[model samples]
Target: MPNKTLRVERVTKRYGALTAVNQLTLTIRAGEVFALLGPNGAGKTTTLEMIEGLRQPDEGRVWWGDVDLAQKPAYARQRFGVQLQNSEFFELLTVRETLELFHSLYRQRLAVPDLIVRLDLAEKQHARVGSLSGGQRQRLALACALVNDPEIVFLDEPSAGLDPQARQNLWAVIRQLQAEGRTVVLTTHYMEEAAALADRVAIVDHGTILDEGTVDELIHRHTPSAVLELSREVGRDVASALSSVQRVDIQADALLLVTDQLEKTLIELVNWANDHQRPLTGLKTRQATLEDVFLTLTGRSLRE
Candidate 1:
C-alpha cells in the first residue's frame, strides 16, 4: 500500500570466473517504465532475476521502497510482479482457470473478468493454455503478472516473439499500466520498442551499464553528427581526399561521414568530383538514431 521505488545499488553476480553482472547500479522511479537493453549474454536477465528475488547477488543490494531484498526477499517480492523471458503455465488450464489460480494466490485479487477483457482474452478465456498461439500465451503470462495488481512489474522481453499487431497490443497494455501509476521495468532487444515505450533506457554490454538516458538524449550524446551516404566506392585516393570530413567510416557498402559542417563537406566533395570529372551519385543524408549510436558504442548489433 505504500509508495514504491525500485533500486539496485552496486549489484554483482558471478559464476566462477564468468561474471554475470558487474557492480551494476540502477534505479527505476515510481510509475515510470525503465528499459534494460542489451544483446544476448549481456547479463540483462541475470540482473533482472536478482532484483526479482529469484537469484541472489554475490554483492550489492536490491531495494523495494525501504525493504532490502537480500534481507527480506518475501517482503520485496510481494510488492512487484514479474513476467520472465520464459513463463510457464499449466498446459491443461483454461485462460480463466489460470487467472483464477493466480488470483487465489495473491492476497489482493484483481478483477479477472476485467483483466481478461483488458488483455484481449475475452474470446479466448475458455481456451486451454496449450492451445493458444504464442502471442495469446504471451498475453496470458502478462495478465498473470498483473493479477496481483502489483505496484511494480518487471517484464523480460514481453514482445519478443509476437507479431507486429500483437506487439502493439501489448505495448498498449503497458502504457495503460503506466497511466495507472504502476512502475514497470522491462528488458528488450528491440530499439524501436525502447524508443516508443521507455521513459528512460539503460544500454548494457559486457555485464555493465554502458549508457543511460532518454532515447533521444542517448542518440544525441553518442551520435551528435549527421551521416552522409555516398554510392561510389571509397578508394584509397577518395578516402584520403576526404580531409574536409571529420570522421569517415564504411558501413556495409556505404560511406558514413560524421561532420560538424555538412554544407562544407558537400561543397568540397562536389568540387573534388568536378575536378576529377567523377560524378557523385546516390547521395543521401540522415540524422543519427539509437541504432547508429548503439552500433557505434558496442561494435555489435543488439541481437548479436
Candidate 2:
C-alpha cells in the first residue's frame, strides 16, 4: 500500500437539533496509532464513521492523501478496514468459518489460517462463535477486520466489556498492528488504552476537538503541575497562600492542590498542618496525567 495521510477537514454532522460533530479538523499520519477519546456521546464514533466512509458528513471533506474520500467512498472502502463496537457473526459458525465468510467479501485479503494464528485464535479455530468468551469474540472481530488487510484499520471501543487480562491481551494485538506499520484509528473511553497505544491522541467532547497531541504534550499543555491530595478540605485562602500552588479544588472528601513546585508545596503544607495541630492524613503527590488533562478540559470523567 502507498503511504497515505487521512485528513478530516472542517467536518460537521448533525441530527435534527443535535449537532453530532462540529467543524472539526484533524490530520492522521501514515502508520501511526491515533486515538479519538471522549465520553459516550462525544462524537468520537461519528467522526470515525465519516473517515471510514461508513457515514456521510453534513459538511466538509475527508481526504485520503489527495483523493477526496466523500467523492470516492468505494475506493476509500477498499483501503479501510472497520470494526464497529458490536460485530455480530453467525453464532453457530466456527471461528474459522466466520473468518472465511468475511474474507470472501473482498478481493484483497489475508490467508485465514495465518490470520487466525496472528490474532491468537488458533486454539479456538474450531470452537463455535457462540461458545467463545468475551475476549475470544473480540479477537474474532479483530481477525475479521484484518481479513481485508486494508491500509487503515478502524476500531471502535475494541476493549470495552473485557476483563483485565483480556483487555491486556487485546492491547498487545493493537500494539502489534502498530509495529507492522498499519495506520490505526481507534475510539475508546479507556484512558490507559489511549495513553498506552496511541502515538498521538485527539480529545473530543461535545462534538468538538478539545485538544490533540502526544499524551505528555497534552498533559503539559493543559495541566503542567503536580497534584497534591489532602485528606481534608482546605480553604481557598489557605491553599492559595502555599508556595507555587496554582489552584485548589475541593472534591467530595479531599482537597486537590495544583502546584508547579512540589518541594515547596510539601514543606508549606507540612508546616501549616503542624502549626494547626492537624494531621496531614492521606496526603499524596502525583504528576499530572491524561486523566487530569481530560478533567481540566471537560470538567467530567471520560466514563461520564
TM-score of each: 0.91, 0.93
lDDT of 2 by residue, 188-218 (tens): 9889999999999999999999999999999
Q: What TM-score would candidate 2 get against the native?
A: 0.93
lDDT per residue (tens digit) for residues 1-304 in model 1: 4567888999999999999999999988888999998887889999999999899899999887887888887775666788999798999999999999988887865899999998989999999999999999999999999998888899999998899999999999999999888898999889889989999999998889998999888988887567677864645357446766765656666666766677778887888888888877768878876777777788755655
Candidate 2 runs further than 4 Å off? 232-243, 250-254
Report lDDT (Cα) of residue 185, candidate 2: 96
Please list the C-alpha lDDT of all candidates, in the order they appear: 0.85, 0.89
Deviation of model 2 at 35, angstroms: 0.9
Candidate 1: pairs in clash: none
Query: Any idea how many clashes model 1 has?
Result: 0
